[model samples]
Target: MPSPLPADLTPTELVELMQRLTLEEQAELDHLLTAGLPRWLPQVGPQTDALESEADIVFYGGQAGGGKSDLLLGAALTRHEHSIIFRRESVQLVGLEERVARILGSRSGYNGQAKVWRLPGATPRILEFGSVKEPNDWMKYQGRAHDLKGFDEITHFLETQFRTLIGWMRTDNPSVRQRVICAGNPPTDAEGEWVIRYWAPWLDPQHPNPAQPGELRWFVTDEEGGDREVPGPEPVMVGGELMTPKSRTFIRSSVDDNLFLQLTGYKATLQALPEPLRSQMLRGNFMAGRSDPVWQLIPTDWVKAAMTRWSPRQEKGPMTALGLDPSRGGADKTSAARRHGAWFDVLVTAPGQVTCDGPTAAGFVAPLVRNGACICVDSIGIGSSALDFIKGLNLLVLAVAGSEASTGSTVAGNLRFRNKRAEMYWRLREALDPAAEPPIALPPDQELLGDLCAVRYKVAQLGKAAAIQIRDKDEIRELLGRSPDKGDSVALTFVSGIPMPGPARQRTAREVPDWRVC
Candidate 1:
């Protein structure tokens, strides 16, 4: 027989029902019995909503510590029996594995897991863990059946990895449809591009959330190279009571979101290191400036002029050194700069030097070589392109080898990358300090200026004594809200200890017109 409909109780009825019950009964009614009911979930603001179609793929993207992962995990538990969770890195999966195991075993932890659980009178075995760091690792679950598949930190994994895993989740639950759930923060320097292309449209700020009523449409590609459009369904409010397909479901939760975030004060201690580290970790941001930024204390007006359209002209001097941030043809930028003793002239060469989006760094060095400058390009990753490019240039293209960069001018392989960056930071700090009286003027580039502003310094303690240490590269990336690669390249120029060159051709008073008089 069909279960009897729940009595439609009004606010008065609810109060009376609670008033008549005993303490134990009232507690049960308030929390255990009525909590999952749609009426009790609180209509304060937009609540947990679900996407339409069990077959559809859902993506939840934003800052860290948002209720995103928590919601995904809760939804996955609904299909307990055939739920598989995929994490990009083994380290992240290990954290999830430990949490799940703890819940299943008898423990002292709160019983929140059981309070929300409901099934067909059976404590069904639901949920499994898997990873895709290496494609072959997915082989272990060949015959696995899952109604729900969750990809945590989806941005970290490649698109191909996600597609391959979804194909494996063949579910048996007739009631529960097969679907994929993804949760992650925004893209970083290391993130791949396809995500920004497909998923970005749906979550990008430009698109109205909940998609302007009927205007909202979700599309899926089918077997035949054709596309079909589907209407976005109101989200299934998990407890079977409330159903909302409202577009206001997206919520931002940062380190401030997690109540448990306080447990990790180590991240907070990082603020003492430098401005770059403090900004990156404390507030989830990225920067191109590392401990030693390329453009330290550069004037604001200089950077503004560059952005406005400063023509790139060969400096009228002997270029002493060159700065290069090689690109791998992958979103990163390739940059080169010629340092004349008194001023530095930088060229983007390709549009992609500030963001990883253009020709490889090695591919952009011909100009510097022709100028007979000492080139210091990043030798990290596919930096070999820089090496090959420089060698082919037959000029003085040297590698900035330390741990990153492929250029040949690396330190004696003795110092770690962090240490080398620290050394550079020390030198930069010295130069920028008013007491040191640095002579060079700041360049006119936004990217360089922003890195300088975001940099910070802190003191480190060793037992009874304390010494100051510059922030690390990762910290710099976080503070700037972009990759600090260009800043690092600039920093390398300072560390190289090569003197800035003077003008190759002398300009007589006749050639140098005093514009002030005109």
Candidate 2:
């Protein structure tokens, strides 16, 4: 529900209303009152902008130790006269309550039972501390109303909970501007994927479609499609009358932006995290995780840095290759990944030609292979047909029989990979390693990143030799509710015999032989 503030209300009225606001509200309103401005540090200037603007929702977060918690608290304080701040666990509020108490000092009266600190008056100003630990806890707030609502460590809550609470951000006082503010650290798993998706365009510093800091974008909820965002508030006919679009703004700030934290060793601590975690926490990367805990591959930071250096050029010496993973079921995806130098970001998937066998599919594949786009196909299920068909054509294609024995990269001792699939995937990891030059860049693909993260490898003994066996896509699909088709497609690109970068003249796709269709 929107605040009761009239569109035509004068600026003077808004100021007069804020003057009598509770201490919490005063903290934030002070800037507005003093100079009709939102005071802020350069580090958190955008945060202030979002809070002061008419934007209904604002997400101020990114890298850890960005003073996100403090900002959230301050924002809550500014609106505390009619405010409610949330923490995931009710217990977490105790520490925050202490901070609130120190700020309120002797001017406030607490009522723990009511979860509120009150400044008694004919029109009393109050600030409340609360929690919504579990999704169901939201039910307790069904009838509550407040102009200001906040969520700290928002990634810890469920999407449904956040949605439900938004419905409660209503107030009779237009002077008490209604705002939803949230803060959190970088997410670590697929569970955080929802938050990432909601804020992706702004969260990704490299996003092609950048949402400027403090700019608002609107989204509408649909019964069929859920919530879909719009570039700006689109006018909607509500009972023959136009309605304003509700908007959201996400402000991204890293530890480096917060001078206080940067002055401490916190930034160094975040940098010390391993691989993807370091990137996720330090860079405030939303797409960093989305992998299963047990199966994460290709450190996220390594991938992020490599993406900056990704050049879609075939190396001068090695041949660029395409990996194909045709869908098994008729409607399943047939994903294809293009390996340019050592990168796996270029991926494409197409459906398999049903009833085709390895020997016959080779006829169609020969033309593509002859054209210099070397092919690597998954030889499992219907793919075996394409594999056999292409092999008979005498084309330079890798028909990967995943279950086949591992043949490359001998172990330090008796350790070995379980099958060809393991060897291929392990090599893909090595290719993504930062030490490998001409860095690999993946497509800005959330699905592919998730797939890569979902692949879990386990070591088991086979006849006195230890071998690593990667989890199958079927297993991964259970975790992600979809096949890792894109991931497998890239993995296929690494099959032995595929061309790799070397010292030679660079070859463009145009240089290959013309395709001879089957």
Best by TM-score: 2
**For candidate 2, lDDT tens digit of each residue in 40-102?**
232335555645667788898877877776676666655446778888788888877777666
What is the TM-score (0 to 1) of candidate 1?
A: 0.41
lDDT tens digits, residues 412-486, model 1? 333222344555544454444434433454455445555544555444553444433456655655443345555
lDDT, each prediction = 0.48, 0.66
Residue 383's lDDT in candidate 1: 60
Error of 1 at 6 (Å): 18
TM-score of each: 0.41, 0.50
Candidate 1, lDDT over the whole model = 0.48
Residue 240 displacement in candidate 2 (angstroms) = 26
Residue 399 miss distance in model 1 (angstroms): 4.1
